[model samples]
Target: MDKIQHQTRPVFPFTAIVGQEEMKLALILNVIDPKIGGVMIMGDRGTGKSTTIRAIADLLPKIEVVSEDLFNSHVSDYDLMSDFVKQQLQEGVSIPSEFIKVPMVDLPLGATEDRLCGTIDIEKALNEGIKTFEPGLLAKANRGILYVDEVNLLDDHLVDILLDSAASGWNTVEREGISVRHPSRFVLVGSGNPEEGELRPQLLDRFGMHAEIRTVKDPSLRVQIVEQRSKFDSDPYSCIEEFQDTQKQLKDAIIFAQSRLHDVTIDYDLKVKISQICSILNVDGLRGDIVINRAAKAFAAYNDKHEVMIEDIKQVIILCLRHRLRKDPLDTIDSGTKVSQVVNDILG
Candidate 1:
């Protein structure tokens, strides 16, 4: 018990986060299908956005990575590794592995390029005058979640760097004659208060799903939130313990869903429906249609369904289409509302 206590710390339970159902579903769907790409969450301040994401960190299952690999490369991704790592593996070198929690890295708003990327090892520079590259947040976030709080406030250059890394699933550092490349596949999670600012188009369009979270407004729900939060604050350990079983169930569900997602078939009708919805919205690119199809399949997987359904597509319509809508100068309605209207006109 003593050793176990030292091994882990209590976190605010995912189940304990009250309301924001859509946001929670969005995160879960991403977990089920990271190929749906990443998620963008827009909400007001103090709305449990960060806490909910932090809660996700605790709920995730541990991953296996090649031992001594700084980038935490998965065994499956070993063949696609950098030339040096690959050569070592081909020489019958003993590659060991250990299990670790899926890394969850926070991208600070004021981070510099070097910090977001990385620099040379100090010991190598001092002892041998050799520049050995070190890993940064992108490296740490490989095969994990790269969470950016207040993403709208990030510098334009930093956002561009992040977008590029996300799109390519790799980060390469070439400055100072230290060339290093590593896989950086991560589920990008960006949350910002829209009132503060708007995300740039390039970065925003990359996200596959977007959710607008509102503060708990119902009196009963608010009371429940206050009560659960106060109880968790008073005794965090017990609170987390109470929800441990539920968290395990969700974690297992995610693992199972991932295994079965590939087999979950989509028919031609569903493809036509998704395309029709995207066509109605006049979304900029094929991303909208692709996201809708992927998010629907993910939604089905989450519900243990082996096939996509119209209801599943409807469930994720706003999340997949809200951020993809083209701006209309004369239109005053919210994008989510417009998406819903279009979905109704087409699907209903």
Candidate 2:
């Protein structure tokens, strides 16, 4: 136990992170409502993208899962359980469970589809008449966050496979006609540097929200960030302890927002206006509108409001719509600026 504890790395607290408010907001909104899909964060190197994402994971409240379940099957939610667990439950088996931190899975850039999606043991099936499915990263990420760093450097085919599973909330693997399908519901967070490469336009649109972050240009803020990181590096446990109270507060806020998200209401007029903005921007599909609605409600709930306010929509609209806009080679303005301009014109 001592060795295990020593091997585990301590995380910097989410509340202790400085600057990059937009990126933080995007992640928080997604946590409040995974149906808002997931956030695509594009930023320069060493902007704390990975650190912030990991901190968010560490800061989340624990969830109960079936004991010894490969998929982290939810203790009660049937939809969140894997096929094997569901079968066992249906057969009247009482499952033992334990609480665990929400999983944060990092997808390596070189991971293959089989490695990510798992595989079937056909020989075992033939010999023993038991379908032995090897669980993969997707199985481990169920009801959790699947993070891909430097996502732009990943193969587009693999990215598509991941997006498909994320959108469908399930992953099915087949080998020689023997198949296994499992719940794969997860918030798919992808971060990459534009200096590497850009995801295809169609692929980029699949993400629910896009947040852009930059290196701190202000000297004082940069110094502060550096100092904070230095402190964390020197003594991670003490640094995390220093912000435990704020971390609990933020975690509580997230839990409250998630519980209240469905109860939060949006006005018909607001919906119409959101669609109008999407139309004016010529967003490819209804995804932009839907994401905006979900994200706005999440923002409202996060602020402890039961009714969606324009301010709530304003806070999330750019994140939802920026990446969906058609590329304009001749246009000098960034997509975020264009989104804000349209929102102002329409909402005003």
Candidate 3:
């Protein structure tokens, strides 16, 4: 059987993406610290959500992984290695490593549970007296990003599966008492239009951050965006060339931030203020406070700072806590506004 290969296409440079700063910041922070969990991007259609997400792959540095490993297992990080690779290591096998672009996988809305999580080859177990496992999107997304467009429209069960693997950093498949498990750690990025529907609050809270974007209302920015698209459509390579320097700068920043993330620290007063805001807002869990701290540290690292400040927390607090606020069917105030008000009251 012939293998199917993906054709590489020109992605719009992340630096060239106009507006939507919140979405961009959220994505970048997650790259620096995937422990912030992942970003849930809710925006209008044609707002370049997918374009911005895909651009992330090209904007970052490559990763070291075991060559030919389906799970993109890291060479030395036992936490990131797949079960198969771990077994190979335990048996004293030499594992070759290679540098590859960080993976970015798109999850189709119509995909099945088996297609998302994987399938166990029960037939092989019966006929060949051996069990084989088929890797799925989760496996491909290991050590990278998994993006789901129109995520609100995805099946609840499938959403649960993605969230579980994303939260646990592993995927397990069991069939006929045969089981296969692999490390599935990756940034889970979900984008959807709120007009279509909304994820249940419980499911929504699972996301680390929520970024809401809208159609660019500034006329000048709109014109600039349109002209940029026209130029890219006319000459993809030259367009990419135009932003190559900036892309490299952004990539360098991400790599450096990742290396220095652990060095960045947040103050106890800021932590107290963050929790106070969450408490005042009646947030359901500690996730809101924790995400804010991690995101602030990531933002500080990205900015070449050794410590997180009130400013860093201020920048991320809204994104981290907005969606976690208890839903008020009758309240007409924007969630971000509410978060900001609490920030001002507590942090000031």
Candidate 4:
């Protein structure tokens, strides 16, 4: 039998993408701090959600990963060992190291549970009669991003699988007298149109930030977007030069932000005020406070500032905590209205 090789897929360059600055910014901020969690993009179809995510692969810097490790586990100076690896070390075997590029794996809506998680490799296990573990999408996405389109429409069982793997940062499989666990940490990126169906609140809260995108309304900008896309579709490489320059600028900014993030501090009084706002708005859970704090810090870092101000917090409050706010029972009140009321009460 001839061995089939995996094909390299092309991604649209981030810089080449048309307007959607808010969505782009949110994703970049999350990348800067995966502790900020993941980003959820809700928007209309053809609004460039998938395109923006794919483009990120080209825009961001490459990461170092363990060669042949299904999950692209990073080998850092700290050398924090995963449970599986710790056991291996305890057994007195030297672990090998080889560097490979990071990956961005897409999880399609129709993906089966067995495929998302791994099933017994029937061919290797039964046909060849060997006990071998086969990795899945979760493993491939480690130290990288996992993008899901139409996430709201995904099967509940698959969603449960994703949520479990995400929280644990590892994928464990036990079947056919084989038990294996592997690190599966990765940033989750999901995009869907709200009109289709609502995301389960639990899964929704798992996303660190949310960005809503819409079609560009400006006539000139819209035309320019269409023209640029046309040109790129015609000659991908020729259009990439201009895109590369923009991507370089973004990469440089990210590097700068990473260095400056820790230096950026938050004021005690402002932190108190942020808590008051969340409390007044009755946002559920502690995620609101955590996200607001991280967003403010990221905003300050992005601006090359040393401290987070009320203004910085205000600028990011909606993106960070808007979805978490409890809806007003009165049909007359909208989320924006609630946000504005809180902002005015605090800033006024």
RMSD of each: 2.3, 1.9, 3.4, 4.7
From the highest lDDT down, the ranking of the candidates is: 2, 3, 1, 4
lDDT tens readout by residue for model 3, 105-140: 999989999999889889888899876888999999
Give the whole-model CA lDDT for all candidates, comma-separated: 0.84, 0.92, 0.91, 0.77
Model 3 lowest lDDT segment of ten: 1-10
Q: Candidate 1 lDDT, tens digit per residue, 1-348?
A: 343245366678897788899999999988887778888999988889988988887788888888878888776576335445676778977778889988889999889998888776766766798868877899888888999999999998888888788778889888655577878888899999988989977679999889999887899988999999999899777777778788889888888888889878789987997898888888888988888888888888878999998889899989988888777779989999998997888778
Who is ahead in TM-score, 2 or 4? 2
Each candidate structure's TM-score, on Cα atoms with residue i matched to residue i, is 0.93, 0.97, 0.96, 0.87
Clashes of each: 0, 0, 0, 0
lDDT of 3: 0.91
Q: Which stretches of candidate 1 lie over 4 Å from their true place?
A: 1-4, 79-84, 120-131, 176-178
Task: For model 1, state the Cα shift of residue 172 in Å.
Answer: 1.1
Better of 1 and 2 by lDDT: 2
User: With candidate 3 superimposed using the best TM-score fit, by how many Å does residue 300's alpha carbon deviate from the native?
Assistant: 0.7
Off by over 4 Å in 3: 1-7
Can you write out model 4's per-residue Cα lDDT over 1-348, one digit (the tens) per residue? 011112154456787777898788888887776667778899999988988888875567776654455556665422323455566557876677775545778998789877787766756877787767667898787777888899999997787778677666778888866666777777788899999997887778778888888888899998998998888788666667656667789888887887889888998888888888889888788888888898889888988899998788877888887677665577587675678688879866
Give the poorly placed runs of model 4, Cα more than 4 Å off: 1-10, 77-99, 120-131, 176-178
Positional deviation of 159 in candidate 4, in angstroms?
Answer: 1.8
